[model samples]
Target: MKALAHLNKYLLKYKWYLVLGTVFTIISNLFGILPAQIVRQSLDLVKDTLDVYFAFQGSSLQSGIRDQFYTTIPYFGFLILLMAIMKGVFLFMVRQTIIVMSRHIEFDLKNEIYAKYQELPMRFFKQHNTGDLMARISEDVGKVRMYVGPALMYGINLVVLIVLVISYMLSVSPKLTFYVLLPLPFLSVAIYYVNSVIMKRSEQIQAQLSTLSTDAQETFSGIRVIKTFVQESFFADKFRAGADEFKKRSLKLVKVDSLFYPLVMVLVGLSNVLVIYVGGQEIINGRLTAGNIAEFIIYLNMMTWPVMAIGWTTSQVQRAAASQQRINEFLNEKTEIVSRKKLMTEVKGKLSFRDVRFVYPDSGIVGLDRFNLEVAAGESVAILGTTGSGKSTLANLIVRMYDPEGEIRVDDVPLKDYEVSYIRRQIGYVPQEVFLFSDTIENNVRFGAGELTMEEVEQAVKDADLYDNIQGFPEGFQTRLGERGITLSGGQKQRLSIARAIVRQPKILVLDDSLSAVDTHTENVILNNLSRIMKDKTSVIISHRVSSAKLADKIVVLDEGKIVESGTHESLMNKGGVYFELHEKQLKTEELS
Candidate 1:
């Protein structure tokens, strides 16, 4: 129950629905109790009519018996039927209101968790996996819904029925009631012990489920790599191991349930046995009537159901508490990168990084150390670096993916001082690893360009030099792609990514090793097209090849997380430094090709 504390606010939001549903539950259970009372009255009537028939013999007795039986018995039968119908109607309303409200809250909770994912920093995602998060949102939330809905409804009804039925039983005979209720305290103690065990097992089951989901998701996502590397057997063994653990945990949970449920049923049966034995003795001694004994049995059954329900409702509550705890962990995670200040001035695209320092969270590797750079508005700067030389880190910093130690500014204002949304919205970034969704080519290109016309989309495609390829597709721009655009070649995927960024016409455009997958001819054509588009916008091109850096206004060479050289390609070539050696090597490779 404490696990569900996070949902208190949402519960308050839909309190009216819960209140009405609870009222329906109470009314329905009240009607449910009427059938037992009707049985008592019917039995007492039959007993009284029989006594009269036995005492007054002959035709008058026969006539009196027939009239009472035909009139009184049918009336009692009609009452039982009417109460059943009323109870059924109210029970339907209880489900509609309470269960439906749980589904609504489930929806809100899932969306809130998704919103949290969107707000959290990239480091958070790097720490968590897709499947574990998916399980938390889907299966864990479902468990919480069970507690809020059926468990809650049944629990309330159990209390109400117990109180009402006990009061009625006390009226019939306090001594019988005392004997009947003796087992209840022991039953409560047993339920408490079972609930604790259930809570522990339920948490273990959820954790195993998360692990199983992660294994399947990761295997499927990397299926191509598995096949290429011929590691299917390895992955299969791993999956089987995870699945075996899940099965073991589930069986343990079932074992707990098996023990708890029957224990309750047997306890309830014992209560019935005690009532029959003691009440029958009282009847033989002429202290209680036969009809009173019959009525007591009916009330005993009424008490029996709620006592049994105690175990089930408590079990559901325990499982829900486990799930609620998991969900709260995610909901409580602090979003590290939030915009604290608003930018009143519009972006002019002049960018600067001053004494910036950055380190990776996982590996503790310094990505950039005392890095400094300044790019004038509308200037084209090409960054040259080897693997892990902070080129990609620099690009990520511009979009505020990870915060750095020193100041990064745009238009002379600190980047942190500006709104995060505005900073990202103004920049067009094509990352080194191109990712395209499973959608039509038109939608992929116009992803962030809301309300973009088809004409604008086509122009962006043409600028990326991918128009001819799209025209060749079976459905042109309407052609669908596979997951991550796996159907397209690497060069086509990279080109499509470029078209996506260019469609935004952003104030700052970043191409982070975007042209690496294409051949020299296509790369030159794309670069030529980009030169025209970049004339009025600040552009940062990160690439390994010297040919890609030839046309830049300035080129900076990075080595071991520090800038080693900054100059035009021609000046760097004359100096015969690292850039000159890279240029010569590329020229040799071009000659060989």
Candidate 2:
């Protein structure tokens, strides 16, 4: 219940809807209880009229009394029917206001969660899995909606209906009403026990649901790997085990849930028995009439559904509280990365890293150690490094994906001083691992800049040396790709990623081993095109191949998170150290191929 208090803002936001729904609930209950009174009066009328007919049995006055009784019974039946129709109308109004408001709140809540996801830093994503995130926004939010809509409506209905029905019963015969409500205290005890059980099991079920969703999502996302390794049976058995656990828990929950209605029904049956026996005693003493007994039974039966609904409403509220707690966990997280300043700064592509140090937060692995570098405006610097030598870390820092320990500046301005969004917009980065959307080729190329024209898209494709291959396809630029661009070859995917970056015409361009998938010939052609395109823009090309580094204005060699060599490619080759050895090994491997 305390967890559900987070929804107070939404309740306040749509306060008018709740107010109207409550009013309608009251009016509907008023109409609903009126029929029981009508039944009582009708029964009493029949009893009185029969006595009069029997007294005039041998007289002509008996015929007139019988005719009047028949005429009056139809009027009471009509009133009951009219009351039901009015109650139905107000019930509809109750749903329209409260139920519809729940839907609006669901919409608002989902959008807020998604927006928070976007605002969070990459480290937050690393800590959580995709399936868990999806479950919160979809399944969790849905449960919360049930609490706000159906549970709320029925809860109000239960409270209001009971008050009106009980009031009428007491007015008719206080002694009979007392006996009729004696079982109610026991029913309250049953509800309290059921509510505690439901709350505990509901949270367990939701947690398991997230785990199951994650398993299924990961299995589907990596189906290719499973098939390649022939591990289908292995994954199937794993999934089966998880499903079995879910079923076992669900049945436990169902067993408890099954007790709700029957327990309510038994209490209701007890109340009815008390009504009959107690009313009979009162009648025998000439203290009550048969009409009073009939009225008491009618009122008790009218309250049956609302009383039964108490358990169900409590279950829904408990489940909602559990789900809201999960959603709040993510909503309360504050992203560490945000703009220190709001003003946008112009970027001219000058980069400076002074004693930059970084360690992976998750693994505690040093990515860079007191590394220093500089690049002037309109300069091209190519970084050559072995595996695990911090080349990609440098690329990530330039894009401000993760801030390093020391100073990093773009255009002589501290990276943190510029608006995060503004700084990211000025850099065009193509990562080592290419990821493409399930969209058309043209759309993927223009993903960074949606406003790019078809002509501009084609120019970028040509610049990446992918124009001829694309033109060969029947759909050309309109060809739709599969997930992660599985329809295209690895080399093609990399080239497509390059086009996506260069299409932005960013002032600072970074290609982080983006050409690793392409053949040497295709790589040379793309590099030649980039040499012309990046003549006036600062560019950083990170790779292991000397062929890629040879055309740079300056070449840097990194080893063990530190720069070991920095000079022109020819100068480094002349030094005959690590760079020279790497060049020799690559040249021989190429000659053999």
Candidate 3:
């Protein structure tokens, strides 16, 4: 209930719908209970007329009385029919308002969760998986919807119907009413015990479901890897283990749920038995009429479903609370990255890193330590490093993907002083691991800048040395890609990523080992194209290849999170250091090939 309290805002948001639904629920119950009273009256009238007919004993007026009773019974029947119709109509209205409001809330809640996901920092995503996040927004919200819709509707109906039916029973005979309700306390106790177990088991089931979803998502995403390794059976066994656990948890919950209804029915049956025994004893003592007993029976029957619904409604509410608690976990997360300033600023690409230090929060590994560098507004610098040398770390810092301990400035302004979104917008970044959407080639190229024209897209693709290949496709730019652009070759994917960055036409372009997959010849042609396009833009190219670095105005060599050498390609060769060793090795490998 405390977790469900978070929904008060949404409840208040559609308060009118709730109010109208409640009103309809009460009206429907009133109409529904009215039929019971009509049944009572019809039975009493028949009982009274039959006694009167017996008293007449074939007198002249006996036939008249019999015909009169027959005529009046149809009127009672019509009244009962009309009340039922009215009850049904109001029930429909109840669903229209309450159920529709639940769907609206479901939509709003999903959007809210998605918006929160977008607002969270990269660190949050690193800590959470896609499946767990999906479960909270989809499955958890669905459980909450059940509470808001059917459970709420039936709950209100139950309360109102019980109050109306019990009041009438008490009015007819208080003693019998007391006896009829004697079994309810036991029912309440059972529900309390069962609900506790249900809440615990429901939470376990939901957690297992998230695990299963994650396993499935990972398997599908890495299907190619499984096939390559010929480990399909291994993964299937793992998935089966997860599924079996889920099944066990679900069945445990189902077992509890299975007991709930029968327990409720048994209690209700006890109440009926009490009604018959107590009412029959009262009749034997001449304290109650047959029609009164009949009316009491009608009243108990009317209360039956409402009483049975108590356990179900409580179960739903408990499940909803568990799910809402999970949802609130993510909703309550505060993102570490926040914009200090929101005002837009123009960027001219002058970058400076002063004693920059950074450590990955999740792994506690130092990404950059005492890193210092400077770049003039239009200079193109290539950074050379082996794996884990922190070359990509510099690229990440340039784009503000992660903030470091020391000062970083863009255009002589402190990096943090500028708006985060505005600065990111001006920087074009292509990361080491390229990601492409399952969209057309043209759309993938235009992803960074949605307003790019077809001609601009063509020029960008041509500059990346991918225009010829794209043109060779059957549908050219309109050809759709498979997931993560798996349909394209590795080099094609890299070039397409480059084209995406190029189409942005940003002030600063950072390519983080983006050309690792392409051949040296293609790399040279792409570099030649980039040299022209980035003539007056600040460009930082991070790669291990000397061929890529040799043409740069400045080349930086990094080892173990520190810059070991910095010079032009010729100077580095003269020094015969790390850069020289890399260049020689690559030359030998190419000659051998």
Candidate 4:
């Protein structure tokens, strides 16, 4: 019930529309009640084959005034037509207003959800499935719209219709109305029990849908890998298992849905039987007119939907409740990293770590233990490490990706004091994994770094050694890239990613195994081009190949999360430490080949 309260926040802008639609519904119900009056009067006007008596006074069931009785026939006829017309108009107004409100609300929610996604940290996406997010923003929001629009409008009609019909019923015979309406208390209890069960099942069904979506999205995007490994049949079996599980849950829900409406129909049927039985005996005893019985039967039939609405509206309300809870869970999530300090601007590249230590959250021992490092502004440094060394983790600390236990600072300011966005703005990162968009080469190069002149764009392309390859295409830089840049070779995609980072023109550039995919000749060419253009920019390059590390002023060797060796190439070679050993091993391997 508390979850439904959230709709009030998102729907604040539409309060006027809800009010107007409600007013229309109330006015429309008044018209619906008039038809009963018309029929009662019309029955009284015509002659009756049998006479009937009443203990208390009541009107004719005929549609208009009597031929020779109470009032003018023409006036009653005009009254009947006017009531019917007004009912139609007001019903239209209510529907039109609610429908417009639904579209407006849907559009705004979609935009707001998308904007929230953009602000969320990268780690948030790594923990959640992309498909589950799509279902929440797209499918679950759709479920809420059904309740807010049609179900909400009809719910209003149901209440007003029941009030009007029951008022007339009580006026005619209070004792009978009490008896006829008595079953409702039990029916409401039954519906509430059913609704609780459905809400739980609805939540499970939505979760299963997210699993299915993630499987489909991953399988489709990596279909080529499945083919390359010749594991298509294995993937197909896994997909089939996921689909089968989804089907089993769906069938269980369908059974619940199937039982609901018919159970409601049976309840309505029982109420109808009581009305007919009591009204018929009254007619036989001459206590009720034939027209009065006829009007009551018609009015009772009209009341069926309002009675059904009690059940129908509750089911959708349960669905809306479930959807709201899921959306709230996502919106309420607080990332492990946040900026509680004032923003910092103009970061200089003097970074220091003093007595720093870190362990993975909610888990085991330190990734780095009491590690310390310092570098001067505009310094070019290279880190060489064997597998399992903490090279990348060290780089991550500089940008505040993980919270360390002790002090880490940039330009004498503790890193925590600087805002994450402002720090990241001055730093550019190119990860080991190269991800590219499915768009033109130009867009991939620009990639959200906006409004670059062609000259500025060409400079990054030249620096990454990709300008010649792109110009060779018939479309030049405008050639369309497939999903994940499928049309380009792996080396080309990596270079394109590098070109994108270079375009940002940051003060500190971090390249994590960036040129590993390129040939030795291409790598040499790319490195030479960078040396010319990157004379002013500071860089930290991670490479296992000493050939790539030889140009740096100093090289740091890492092993088992600690610095094992540090010096210039000639000094490290003269010292015969780990770096010189790795360099000699690679040189001998190359000579033997």
The lDDT leader among the candidates is 2
Sliding window of 10 residues with minimal summed lDDT for model 3: 336-345
Question: How far in Å is the alpha carbon of 516 misplaced in model 1?
Answer: 1.3
Give the per-residue lDDT digits (tens) of candidate 1, residues 1-593: 77688989988999988999989988998898788878877887888888777777776668868686889899999999999999999999999988888888988999999999898888888898899999999999999988888888888778777888888888878998899888888887887787789999999999999998999999998999999999999999998999999899999988877776688788778888988899899889887777777777777777666777777788888999999899888889997677768775678799999999999897898999999999999998999989999899999899999999998999899998888887898999999999999999999998887789899999999988999999999899999999989989999999999999989989999999999999999999999999999998999999998888887899999987899999998899899999998988989999999
Question: Under the 3 Å rule for N, CA and C atoms, how many clashes does model 4 have?
Answer: 16
lDDT by residue for model 3 (1-593), tens: 99999888999999999999999998988898777778778887988899999999969999999999989999999998999899999999999999999998999999999999987877788888988988899999999999989999888888878888888888889999999889888888888889999999999989998998899999999999999999999999999999999999989988988887898788778888888898999989988877788788777777778778887899899999999999999999997666666657788889898999989888988888898889999898999999999998898888777788999999998888887778888888999999999999999998958687789999999999999999899999999999999999999999999999988999999999999999989999999999998888899999988888866789999887888999899999999988899999999999998
What C-alpha lDDT values do all the predictions have? 0.89, 0.91, 0.90, 0.78
User: Which stretches of model 3 miss by more than 4 angstroms?
Assistant: 285-287
Each model's TM-score, in the order given? 0.97, 0.96, 0.97, 0.89
Model 2 C-alpha lDDT versus the unseen true structure: 0.91
* lDDT of each residue in 559-586, candidate 4, tens digit only: 8777888888899999998998999998
TM-score of 3: 0.97
Candidate 1: misplaced stretches above 4 Å? 59-61, 284-287
Tell me the deviation in Å of residue 6 in model 2.
Answer: 2.3
Q: Which pairs of residues have clashing backbones in candidate 2?
A: none
Indicate the residue-level lDDT of 417 in model 1: 83
